[model samples]
Target: MSVMIYPQGRTLSFVYGDERILVCREDRPKVTSRVQIKVYPDGRVVAAAPSDIDDHAVLVAVKKRARWIHQQLRDFRQQYEHLIPRQYISGESHLYLGKQYMLKVIESEDHTPQVKLLRGSLEVSVRQRHSGNVKTLLAEWYKDKARDVFARRLDAMLEHTLWVSERPQFRTRVMQTRWGSCSPKGCLTLNPYLVKASRECIDYVLLHELCHLAEHNHSERFYRLMNQIMPGWQSVKEKLDGMAHRLLLN
Candidate 1:
C-alpha cells in the first residue's frame, strides 16, 4: 500500500507480515514541527507532525530510521514464531499472574475440561474418552483465567486512582499487534495473549489505558501523570517492551 501523508504534514505508513501495523499521527498541535515516534504495545507505529513539516522531510526521517524499524519488525516475528510451537504438557512451565507454574495434565471421567491452580502448579483435567484436542481445551482455560484476573486488577486500579468518571468497559481480543487500547468513549480492550506475560506487564498495560481515561494524548503532561501514579512506570515499560513481541506471538 502507498504511504499516506496528511495535508497537515502527518505521515502514515505500514508493514505487513506475521504482524501488521498502521502508523499515523496520535496528535498534532498547530505549532512547532518536531518528529515523535511511538510504537504501541500491540505493534502499531504513530508518528507525530509539526505544522512546518513536509512530505520530503517525513520521507527523510523514515529512511534514516529504516534500520531501526526493520529490526523491530524482525524481533517481533522471531518472538512470535518461537512461542507458537509451545505445547501444554505435563511439567511444562507457564506464567500465571506474574508467577511461573508447572503444568500437570490429569485424565478424568469428567464431562468437561477444567483447569485448576494449586500450590505452584496448574492442573488441567479433560474427559478421558473425549477426542477433543488438549491444546484447545487449555487455551480456553487460559482465556477464562485471564478475564478474571484482568477484571480484578481493573477494579483495584479504578478504586486506587479514585477516578470519578463512568467505569470503562473491557473486552478481550486476539490481536497480532497491540496489548491494549482505550477508545474516546472510555472503553478498554486488552489482548488475551497478555496472559502469557508477567502480571506486572499486564498491569502496566491496564494502567496505560486507565491513564488514557484522563489524558487521551501522550503529551508530556500525560506522561507526568502516569509517572505520578506509577512511580516505576518507566522500568515497567522497559520490561514490557522486551516481552511484547513474545506475548503477541502467543
Candidate 2:
C-alpha cells in the first residue's frame, strides 16, 4: 500500500496487488463534503472533492466499495496474466487497422528503424546492435504511427460528424493510464498504444476526443451525440476496453 499527497492538497491511498485506490479531498467553504468514486478498467478508484473533507468519512465510503474493487481486480488479473510476458519473436501477432499482422523481423544495415507492410506482413528493421531492444524500438515505431494515423482520423471526424470550423492541434505520446484526453483549448493528446488496436478502435478513440470539443462530459447528451455520429459506438467502446486491458498487460 502507498499513500500520496498531491500538491493540490488531496490525498490518495492505493493498494497495488489488489489494484485498489482511494482519494480524499477537503470540502469547500459552503459545500458539504462527499465522496465520488469512479472505477477504471485498470482497477483503480478515484475519489475527489474540494479541500476540507473528513478523512474518516472518505475511508468509510471507500470501504463500502472495497469488495467490488477487489472483484474487478481479480477478474482483470485472470484475464490478462498470459499477456504480461514480453516476447519479440518473429511471426508474433500485432494489431493494425482492426486486424492482426504477423511480425517479420529483418536484419538490415539501415541507420534508423523502419516498418513496412508487405503483402500481409509487417517487416521491421532495426540496427543489429539494437536487436535486443525490440520492445522499446517497436514502442517508438508505434508512437510515430499513432501520431500520423490519429491526426487523419481526427480530421475526418471533425469534418464529417460535427462540422467544426476550427482545426485543433493534436499530439501523441505513451500514456500509462488514459487512452486520450482533450483540453478546452482544443489541444488533444493520444496514447501511443492505440496503434496496437484495430483501425476502428483507434477511430473510436479519435472520435471520442474530438467529441469532447462539443460535449466535455460523459453526460447523456454527450453519448447521444456520439451514437448519432457513430452508430456502433457502444460495440466499439467494448472492444476498445478489452484491448486496453490486453495492451496494459503486454
Candidate 3:
C-alpha cells in the first residue's frame, strides 16, 4: 500500500531524557513504511515520519530508541572531543600543507596584514594601527594560501580525470562546513581551511569533486572510478576525517 502524504507539515522540538530532538514532518508520498531517525556527527537529533504520523508518534518512536541515540552520541563525542576552540595566538600550533607549525604574531608599523611560512612557523605580521580579531586575520591569510595552492593542485590532478573535459573555474571561500563542491556549470568552491590539511587529503577532496563531472552522486561506479584514478583514496580519506574537527571547527 502506498503511504499518502499530508502536504503540510512542520518541525517540532522536544526534550527526550535531557537531549533535545527535532521531529520534521513533510508531505512526501511513499510506498515504504518505516520510522526513520538520524543522529548527525555534531550530535543533532532529527527524526522523520510519514505526514500522517503526528509529532507524538515520532516522539514515542524516539523514546523507544533512546539507548541507541545515547550510544551514537557517545561515539561522536569520543571522535570529536580532541577539537578545541582556537585562540589564534602565538605559541599555538597550526598546520599548513599537512605540516604542523607554531604561530608567531608580529605587530608591525605596516597597515596590511601578511602571513608566511618561515622555517617551521606561521608568521603573521599584523599592523599595529589596525583593529580586528586575530582569528579573522589568520583566516584571511589561510584563504589566500588555499586559493593559490588549491588551484595548482586542481590543475595537476585534472590531467588524470577522464570526466573533466575542460578546465573548471575554482574559487576559495571560508565555508562553515564542507571541504569543497563542484557545480554543473564547472565552477568549484573550496574551503580555505583545506590549506591546513595534507597534500593527499587536499587531492582527495579535489578529485572527489572532479569525479562528480561524470557521476553526480556517490554510486558504486563512482567509487570504482575513484579507485581507478587514485588507488589509496580511502586511506587518505581516513586521515582527513581524523583531522577535520581541528581544521574546520567553527
Could you say which candidate leads in lDDT? 3
On the 0 to 100 scale, the lDDT of residue 97 in model 1 is 62
Q: Report the error of model 3 at residue 221, Å.
A: 2.1
Candidate 3 lDDT (Cα, 0 to 1): 0.72
lDDT against true structure, model 1: 0.66
TM-scores of all predicted structures? 0.65, 0.65, 0.67
Model 1 lDDT tens row, 140-167: 7778877998898888777756563666
- Compose the digit string of candidate 2's lDDT tens values, residues 126-187: 66735466666677777778888888777777776654668889788666757778887868
- Candidate 3: give its CA RMSD in angstroms: 8.0
Query: Backbone clashes in each candidate structure, one number apiece?
Result: 3, 8, 0
Worst 10 residues of 1 by lDDT: 1-10
lDDT of 2 at 1: 7
List candidate 2 stretches off by more than 4 Å: 1-84, 109-112, 129-132
Q: Rate the local accuracy (lDDT) of all candidates.
A: 0.66, 0.65, 0.72
TM-score of 2: 0.65
Tens digits of per-residue lDDT for model 3, 69-152: 778877988977776666667887888888988988888765567777899998888866233455677778788889899989
